[model samples]
Target: IVQTYVENTRLIWYRHFCNCTLINGKFIFGYYRLIPSYGLELIVEILLNTRLISISSTRSNTIRKRLHICQPFINKHHFEYREIIDIKTNESIYQLNLVVVSSNKDTTLIRLIENFEREVLKYPNRHQCFTLTILYFYQKNQTINQIYDLIHQLSIKYTSIIRLSIINQNQINYNRGLGRQLASKLFSNKQLLFFLDVDLIFTGQALDNIRQLMIHQLSISSCTVYFPIIFSYFSSMFNVNNRTVIDINSNIGSFSIYGYGNVVVRKQDLDKTGGWEINNHEWGNEDVNLFQRFSESSSECNVFRTVEPGLKHYYHKKMCNGIVNRERQKICYDADGVLLGSQRNMIIIPYGMSSISTIDCSSFEPYDKPISTWKTLVTNLNAAERDYVKSYLGQSLVEQCEEIEGEIDSLLDIWRDYRNETVANCTNPTIHSLAEPPVLRQRLTTEIEFFVKHI
Candidate 1:
């Protein structure tokens, strides 16, 4: 499957490593490999064509191992797995099987699947070392859907590497555990299974990392599962062109530490652990429950976890109405609010402003840091930034500062009353609600927004 795909597509632009420089028609590279031993210009052209050399069409090191927008930026999955060999190296490439779960209402399923094919499978190869299984869950009445037809087409096209399965949904809501179990059973072999979400964009290197970790450390001696932390992108509004929104300069996307669903485990362990627990608890909280089960069960699983920068969860609207419980709703709301825009962009100014002024909305009072470091409109601005702020707020910096000082007096009174109410009725935080609380930042943002708008 991999050889045929590689030959047909010629998309292995990312697999090779070359850190050489071309100077005055002379190839100057540090590393000495069998290729350099050939001593022919034709070899360089061949290497360049196969993407084995680091040289691009412009004769630059395209695959240098520095932080790149193309890399991490996520990889592999499973059940009956297949082995793929590199056509160049003649080495066996690791195969990962993907089990993607989604409901019929997930409108972006088709588009995301297309993205998965384009970004991962067809090229440099996320799917090169991976097999895919789409577990489509649908209500009995809403059985016939376009997703069905699309999956059918995919199954035919990628026959060696793809399978499409459907589960009859008795309830309107998706039972993630049930869907996973159904998919696991469909696997012919006890393959390593990746419980994947429908809306993830992964990289080939990420897949390679996953496969290497599992292939090396995974043992039936004890249960093992790989839980990779995924980076969630900000809203599409901030990225109209959607060109590499990688947070190279500043933190652009939110690193989701609470989300525990996207995971990799063996089929045997999943069965031994009694599969995913049926959670009547929180919405989209199935992964958390599963993780807990893996950690706290009778036969404890040795779960492996690492921050995978390549695994990215793209922005999408959430159905957080009756579906999510109180805690779940808050998480959903937080994710949705973040996707609406980051605090920096969401503080949209009114009237005929620059139409594109950046809001330096700093992080909230870090639970550990001193609150004085907070970036209010008044404090912490350099001289140049202060001048920019003066124009940004459409008022004198000194006058605005003076007005905000007065405004603080009124806000303190409101705060005192709120503090008393909090003292009167605050309770211990629950497990589900105990991660990163946005209370301080939320208030700070509100106050800053109000002051700026009024000014």
Candidate 2:
């Protein structure tokens, strides 16, 4: 039957067979005489009906010359396989809902959103599953129309990936934790919720890292919460004119983990813990309070502190001025800095670990004393007394206070020097001092460099 079919079709398909060679008991066609472009397809079709187990191209000049013609089809199929893999990978990625709270009309908000979108777009697979919920906590001074316009523009620009939600409220009573809880409630479809401050900008690699962490957590169970260590620092104060510039070489202590900054928790886990506490509207210790609540939640819940650097905080004066007041609220935290409440402790399950551990907040001394008394104790402590103070306050809390004190002192020194130079240049003017203005400016620049490099 095969012999008859080949003989009968030989007349019509003779040109296709003209360049044929029998290798390893299978017919290999070199080129099609009439339709060269359709040659590979025809060969593949013919082989599908035959007893051939495999296909190969010849290395001879005749076959190699026309082999280049089939390059497009080969590349096309290659991309098709890649597209399939990408789609599968994307489907596996769990949904990440980023909740951002913006109250004031800080111009930096736009930059923060842009940088976030840019970072999310870097991972196409992850971006497809990511959603951004922006909760605009309304203030009286902020222009309502301007806020609407900004929201509209962002909605249109990120129509495909981002799910934007803008909520308006009349009072200035919205805190970070409350705003995040509201945003999470607004978007119920998301599996994971990441609370992000409006002033913080995350890198693309950092986003990818968080995505992987979320995926790992999801694989274990849907009720898992992860917190990435936020790298927070004031933008170089001396170089106020240069926005978006951060000192990369600064110590890790400069980037303390603020409770409100880069926090990742499962929506289900949040629900289990009754979401973030909304009572603290003044933005003081809401994040810390919420963290303590999570720690004291049910034992099945998994909470972890990721040691990776995933988020960076931009410099803002409001944050700098509010630090002292915020730190004062930390006295409510246990000696280990965990919020005080609940005899029932929450379990912390590290990534890739089957065993679970509880946060022991019992060893630290009680924060019954006022902030002034605590400051007095810290100030009067000698080397031995300092170690004793650390034992009561916990080493982490003491180190953080010391770091903040150093930073404040450095900032005050820089401000004084800059002010003195400006006043001197303005008050005492001479022909030689005309050149002194430029010299003073140069000195200011040098001082900024020295501060960033040495500090």
Candidate 3:
């Protein structure tokens, strides 16, 4: 079947337009070059029957209008996979080989693995059809360290779901590409391979869409791969890391249009397309390199860059592993400095009152609109609004602001102290320095700005 795909590709590709090898020679006609255009339709005779698949049909027109995908930089479709969603049983055309790259003995693996079991493995379609390989960082002693100890527990708890592949190096620096490439080698070249990180949380619904796209949209002849646009959270402070935030609409994260990781591809397709760049290590540009290669106009490979719902990247303190090129270093630092999603207004209203429960972990959405009257009354108590709170709510407002000023107002100061302790706790200086103290302060200020609508 692979050889047949290669043969068909060779016959169809024009060397003047694409990277594929020529069958006999080059095509002199420019019109033939138009065959590969995104919107252009052509005949593709496949097994059992013939179907007319339109080019790049996104499920949601609303998100596409907001997505702003440049010409070919990112694949621009949002497929909800509404057809397969209701099927509690999802049997796909291919078996999924999920490679979750982990290093540094982190306890967050517990959240990741458990969430995977609850969300992805809950469906009969995935639980039976998937093989999860954890590419763990090197460890000599499992008892002393929290990260290693958790891995030990994981091996026992998820024996059915996990196959541990420990890297035999001290690995002071994280080589994401190397870890992913190594994991890929453990699987059959013909099987479907998904490269992932521990910070990602995805639902069974997302898996259904991914499988749908992988089976139907991907073709071996064109070397197609899928990079789903995941929603990335701002900070753990906004209740984003709370595993209970399952609904994508309820999520406080923004869609990362530029993120090219979280890939789903057949191992055979990956091998043919110059697999991952093993040399580009340190949590940078590794994913981007593959995306860029196929995004080119002349490339024979077809990349299905779609914004599939249900995948989420939880917040973490990120630092450029200091090994990527100057360009990626800038990209990494710029990513580190971002935080507008934590706006209080975006938090409160989006989920209505359930957000109060999600954020505090102590409340739930009420049966009635209990607080609506007072909430409306205070805001309208004279246009000046300075003395408005004292009108009805009284000392309640003053007392709460006092508590906020005394406690929550010093979030930056508290973070700085925590950063210092973590140095003693500060192993995360890059994240704490760039993402926490400054960005938290910035987010808080920005929230006030967004609320007040003033400078």
Best model per lDDT = 1
lDDT of 2 by residue, 79-136 (tens): 5421112223345236566777877745767777678667775566556667677777
**Which regions in candidate 2 have their CA more than 4 angstroms from the true location?**
1-93, 122-126, 144-147, 238-247, 251-253, 258-260, 318-455
Candidate that beats the other on TM-score, 2 or 3, i.e. the better one: 3
Which candidate's TM-score is highest? 3
Q: Give the Cα error of residue 197 in candidate 2, in Å.
A: 0.8
Whole-model lDDT, candidate 3? 0.55
lDDT for each residue of candidate 1 in 1-455, tens digit (9 for 90 to 100): 22233343333322343233322121111111233443312111111122223345544332211111111211234235545433321222235678887876456678667766765557644445677788777777774657777767877877766787766667535677767777888664447777777878777677767876776555333556788878888655444224574452122476666678798887877877677766553456667767766754244556666678888887776666665367777666655655544443323321111223333434322222223322343354445334444444346544655554455445445545555565567675343223233564466446656765654
User: Against the hidden true structure, what lDDT does model 2 obtain?
Assistant: 0.50
lDDT of 3 by residue, 1-455 (tens): 22354455555654334433322211111111123344433222111111222455422211000111112223446434333233222333366767888766366676776776677556655665565788877555543355556556755865665677766665534478878888888877667787876888877777756765666555434466778878877654334345445545434667777788788887877777678888765657888887766554345555666565688887776666553477766566556534323434323432223343333211211122223223443344333232422332346644543443334335546665666666674455465434454565565545433433421
The models' CA-based lDDT, in order, is 0.56, 0.50, 0.55
What TM-score goes with each of the models?
Answer: 0.53, 0.49, 0.54
The reply for model 1, stretches above 4 Å from the true place, is 1-94, 119-128, 140-145, 170-173, 219-221, 236-251, 279-282, 297-299, 338-340, 346-455
**After TM-score superposition, what is the CA distance of residue 248 in candidate 2 from its true location, in Å?**
2.6
Q: Give the clash count for model 3.
A: 5
Count of steric clashes across candidates, in order: 11, 1, 5
Clashing pairs in 2: 295-346
